[model samples]
Target: MTWSSALKKTARDGLTIERTRLEPLLALRGAAGVAIVVGLLLAFGTPKLAVSSAFGAFAAGVATFQRTWRPRVTLAVVVAVGLGASTFLGYLAAPHHAVFVALLAVWTLLAGMAWAVGPVSGLVATQTIAVMLVTVTLPTSVVGAAHHAALIVFGGLVQALLVVLVPIRRWGRQRDALADALAAEADYARRLRHDPTARFDPQPLMDARDAAELTRRQARYRPGQLAGPRGVAERLRPVLASLADPVLGAPAEGPERDRVRDLLGAAATVLDAVARAIRRGEPVRLPPEAMAVLEVPESGPLLSGPARRSALRLIALLGDVVEASDEPVRTTGPATEQERRDLLRPSVPRLVPVALRAVRREARWSSPIARHAVRVSAVSCAGYLLAAGLPLGHGYWAPMTSVMVMRPDFARTYERGVARFAGTLVGVGVGGVVTAFLHPGVYVSAALAVLCIGLLYLLMRTGYSVTSACIGAYVVFLLGIAGEGWSQTVQARLALTLLGGLLAMAAYAVFPAWETPRLRDRLAGWLRANGEYALAVLAVYARPAERKARRVREALLDSRAARREWEDASARARKEPVRHRGLSRSAERAAEAALATMGRVTMLMEAHLPDRQAAASPGAEEFASALRAALPDAIAAIRERARPDWSGPRRALAEWQRREGDTGVAVRGAELLTDALDELSEGLAAPRRGRAGRGAGRG
Candidate 1:
């Protein structure tokens, strides 16, 4: 090759490399800016502080990246209060050999306290540990610790203030993000629709599913902790609900219905993809084929005039903004009336009630019982430490911290316990080695400190297992610095850690904070919520209007979430050999029935309103009333296990469905509603029959 050509090629390759590398580096720089500000504040502020301000600042950065914060002011206040209180406590308990140890204890205690309140509590606890280790370890005296704590606090507060005050021009970006997700979903749906025989592709679909799941999970955290972007799940809920509706089944011989359905499905896929991308902390990317499909302008009443214009504009903006920001978009954009209508169009039969149920599922994770369990576990850990009378060092604080940090699930608790025990043993052993060979000095200690930080940052970024190993290494280093003989120190530290792990495990498993048993109750609640949402949707559908359909779609999303949660809980429960089989089976059946109900509801809604352009009919009103009335009884059946009596509503719906005249459409809807009611009745009865069959088989 010629030298000039070679040089040009090299330049092109270098530019590509630089671009790829720079994006992440820039993101990191943004993170570091937040950390530096926090570090500076810690270096100067609060004397004898336990937890560091840098932690809070870093947390603010994380929250910003997550785009979770809503009502930014509230988030800022909560963060400030939590960090300040932890710092103050640390400052008050300074000047002792075990001051750092005490700080760990305080952090765990506070975090546990927060977890009891909600998921945000756990996040706060994690931030506390990260900040304190970074900011406080350098100081030798209580006074120095306090000053560092103040500096850290200042840094965090500044970061929070900046985030709150900064007016990001995100509307265009958000709109673009939504559009991208919609376009992707539409393309996926079109592919699926066309293939007819194609099964769901687990890989691509998994990412989208994960994204939706993550959005729902993250929503449990305090509003301001992450960017308060409108989630893809929320945005696409209406569309998905419409698709699930039975009334909108196999499109009649018309291009409009087909086109709209494809668009709605594509939107669902895109939302799922966008949600997943955000959760993974990556920029959203559209599938090329899907993008190509979306670009095509298929003529249809659905894509005509203003509605079509709005969708195209929305999609174009989403593509442009997502490309420009280089960050995952948050759900902050306002929903347009047309966009909202498209979302709410009850194409899927019986969608209103089903969607409501799905949304209610989303709400279940934030329920009081779940929050209580986390809190009680935290309190229990603290109580164990105080009762043991173990010295205020790694021995007392490590175990307590573990309990507060571990998830409410048994599997997570078990893994964390094992990791904690192993890490403690290894760390103590390493500490002994260092103490025996190299005397603890300023240089050795400083080297160890830096090593600890590097290990923590790296391992934590990787996964839980690596993080456990790093924790172990850190503890060993810390013990060596405590001026003890190698053998004796190692033995003592190991024994203490074992005790702490046991106590933590006990606290997690014990009463006043039981998690496993509560799964059943949570499932029950989800079912009840699903029923309520379904009823609401039915009421809205009775009056043929876009607004009512939108409500129905929202409710269906809630039901879907509930079903997903129930499935997760059931899977977890089954993993335990000692799990209550009876309860598990009952919960599973309830979940199944709920899922079926949601699906049926989606179908019914769609059948009633096959075309959005159609005017309301009298029969639509009658069917709506019947659905509303039936919903309460259906819910009661699921919750109370009462047999569903569909005789009255079934007859009314059947008459409407079979009626033939000027109100032929209304009559058809009534017939579908009748079928839906019958199916629901069967669904309610199946669980009981299954239980009986199981019992008979066992006998």
Candidate 2:
């Protein structure tokens, strides 16, 4: 991609307004919490105190919208505690410019590194720094600072308490996550009826796994419908693929293939019902047609041996899903070890060390997170100093805009910069009109600010532009309590916002951590993960054991994560203006396709994994060894931009094919996998061949 094209694409991305589901009830609850905190403060204290404390309430409410695995109350409390701590520290540092700038650099740096944990953690951390930048001006002395901090903490606690007492859609996140996974598989099954080789995105299943993790306390109240179905949906994916694969289960054009398609359709319907049941917290309503399809005898000649077995397994898993839906919610008893293990979350206080450790690990220069930290820190400090040097009174707005808008990637940083500036402009314009025309008193200003906050919550998911507009009005009305009218804010706010946004974009353009340069590394990592999955499954066949079963499960998870990483890199790289250094766009696409094909073949083999007490598959040991040895070399070849050799696997595959006489499902899948690898080798070699041909012509 060229720079011009990249800019054009990012501009459209920035301007694009997504259509999100309307959550009026949830939005109202969040806004009501903010109103409660502000109202109580105004009744007991001054208007300034209420306005300052509103930051904590607003931030806590925003935390609930984060897409994290943590409970809503936990997130709210954690965010509140951070707000209080940041307020105390910021107040102490505000009196001295030097101390404050130093603190800003360090705080923003940590906030940048927080991305290493996840986006939610990073967003929460950055929001604290932005809030600190604004609220520090509210406190005058040490005692005053403590009082302000306590009030902020009180506001957050109020929000958290509302989460507990009101409890809109209790355990809603868990149910939705589990239901989404089933829904994804249902969709996949429907797609496979037409495209037998359709690839399944593992994101939903991964989300389901994350949702299933529960603390002992949480587990005691676990809803039974959420349980059992997660694992069943997970195991069903491979069997569905296996049953649909022409090489594994059916003829390319025959009655068996038709039956396979029909089975997939029925599976999709059944799974969809289960998903709806789980989502609605109702009993499983099995569709009559799907039940009839499942009840069909597997003794027919349409499917034989392993094919028939896959069909039976699919039905059994579907039955398990239906049975589990009827289970009553469990309200008592100790959580199982399987439910608690590493999935058990530490309390918020203990979580700080874990977060700190993760940030420290990403502090090295090679980490993109570290580079982002450096970028934000420098941009924030520069924006603040520049704003201060000029006549812009509220200099914090500059650095606050930079901090909130900047992200780790070029696309987001640039897109958000443009979006934030435009949003703030529109936001301030509306706010100026309201204050100039209405001239609301202190109580009315508070009411208008609360209304703005409510709209901010309501429109948050619509797009950043809409939310930014509301935030603009919110700030205007909020500071009105301190007697800063529209005239004082109109000029300074818009100018400083533009300055900060420009600074953030320039910082990224000058020091970008381009994903294009690392495309080969990402591809190699994916290849290694794919090989590990294939080898794990083959090892189970070579020598079945309970340990290998666990290994296979772990490998499957690792491979899915790796696949997501590669896909993300590819997507980011395409948007980047930087030229691909080692891997061309065509080669990248082909390599990804080949890898996906190989993965599907491996999954088909895994669908018929031998029982622990059963005899090992013939020649499984040789094939596993050969494939295992080839993977490291293949990964190395990928990194070097050379053709990968898989002769050993090919030899073993041929021998196994001949030994198996009739060519079993595993042997056939292995042949397909090797064919996919051959395609991968050709893809990696094409760029080299192109360059060589050009060199020869020049010579």
Candidate 3:
């Protein structure tokens, strides 16, 4: 794609508004916290104090809305405390221009590096830099700075306290995640009734697992229902796959197929019912007919051998799900203790070492995250200086815009830059009109800010542009309370905001953390991870043991993580200006399909993994070792543009089939798996620049 087309596409993307659900109660609750902080100070102390401290409450509220696994109360406290510290420190440095800029560079650097931890942490940390620049402008002595910082802390604590007191959706995130996972399985089962080769994304299960992770305090109060359903749903994946796969579970035609469909339909019904019950925190309500279908036929067996066993296992698992739901609503009982051990999230105070290790991994120059750190740190100082020299009334607006809009990627930074300028144009105008028309005093301005905050909360998920608009209006009203002109400072604000956004855009254009160049690297990482996962599954068949089962589970998770990384990199690379970097567009599509097939085959094998007492499958040990031996060579070939060494695995599979023809279901899967790997190698060896539909559909 050309630069103009990419620019137009990104611009169009930036303007697109999405439909989103609104949490009116949650939004009101958050806004009320901000309003309370602003109100109490305005009523008693002073406008400046109220406005300065309001940043803490406002920021804390914003942090709660991020897609984080951490407790909302924890987010509020940590984010607020960071803001307070940044504000106090920023105040001290404000007296010296060089020192303040230096501090900002360091802060931005750290904030950028925080992305190594997670998006939530990075976003929350970045906000502190913006707040630091804005709040430090409040003129104060050292002691006064301390006082302002304390009030900010107080304001943040107030929001956290509200999160605890109201508890609108206590354990809501966990319930939603678990329900989503169950629903996904239900959907997968329904899909299998039609297309047995149907694929399932494990993301929902991953989300449920993440939501299950709790600090010790959190684990104590966690509901019992969240626990058993997730594990049961997890086990059901393989069983569903096993039942659907022709090689392992059911035949393609006749009475067996009909029974398979009927059983699947029944299971879907049961899963959907359980999902609905969990989502609403209501009693489990099973469909009578569906339960009847689950009962084995009295006359004769519909499915023989493996299919029967799979059906029985699935029935037992569903029964476990129902039983888990029957536990008392609020329990700190044995389930709680077991879940605590199963899903322990480290306490915040204990995260220092973890943070250090994560940051250390991303510290190398080769890391895109590290490059982003350098880019943002340098851009922060440059934007601040340029905006300061332009005589803007609120110079920090320029740098803050840059900081907020700039991400580590090309698409987001450009998209958000455009959205920021456009939103600011409309937002400042609306805020200006309100202030000019009403001639409102500090109290009225405070009310307007609170209204904007409420809108911000309710519509934050709608789009980036909407969020930018709300924030712009909020800053306008907030500054109005701090004694900015009642007239719309539209011209000044827009000019500075545009300048900041442009700097952000230019910075990325100059030195980007492009996913395009890293596409091959991502694919190679995924290939290695997927190979390990497949090998682990093969090992379980070779030597079926409890320990191997654990190994298989761990390997599956690692592959899932790797797959996500590859998927994310490809998604980002699609929007990038550099379309063909390491892989041509067509090659990428084929390679992606090949990778998906590899993952799916292993997942199928994983589903029917044998019991500890079962005999080892034919050639499992030899084939697994061959795949393991070939994996490193394949990874290197992907990177070095050489022929992949699949000979070992091929020989193993051929030898197995020769010595023991058609006996091993896993051998059939391994054959298909090797076929996909060969396709992946061909994709890398030559870029398929054929007709649009041709190269894309090969896998």
Would you estimate the TM-scores of all the predictions? 0.61, 0.96, 0.96
| RMSD of each predicted structure | 12.8, 2.6, 2.5
Q: Order of all candidates by lDDT, from best down to worst?
A: 3, 2, 1
- Spell out the clash pairs found in candidate 2: none
Off by over 4 Å in 1: 1-81, 90-113, 125-191, 194-394, 405-409, 423-448, 458-462, 478-493, 512-541, 545-550, 553-561, 564-568, 575-614, 660-699
Candidate 1 differs from the real structure by a C-alpha RMSD in angstroms, to one decimal, of 12.8
Error at 31, model 2, angstroms: 0.8
Deviation (Å) of 493 in candidate 1: 4.1
Measured on C-alpha atoms, candidate 3 has an lDDT of 0.84
Every candidate's lDDT: 0.46, 0.84, 0.84
* Per-residue alpha-carbon lDDT of candidate 3 for residues 63-181, written as tens digits (9 for 90 to 100): 99888778899999998899889989988888888989999999999999999988988998898998888864678579877888888888899999999999888788788899999
Residue 441 in candidate 1 has what lDDT?
Answer: 57
User: Worst 10-residue stretch by lDDT in candidate 1?
Assistant: 14-23
* Between candidates 1 and 3, the lDDT winner: 3
Comparison by TM-score, 1 against 3, better one? 3
lDDT by residue (tens digit), candidate 2, 325-406: 7666555466767655746766666777988888788878888899999999999889888988887688888989999999
Model 3 misplaced regions, further than 4 Å: 334-342, 545-547, 686-699
Q: What is the lDDT of residue 694 in candidate 2?
A: 27
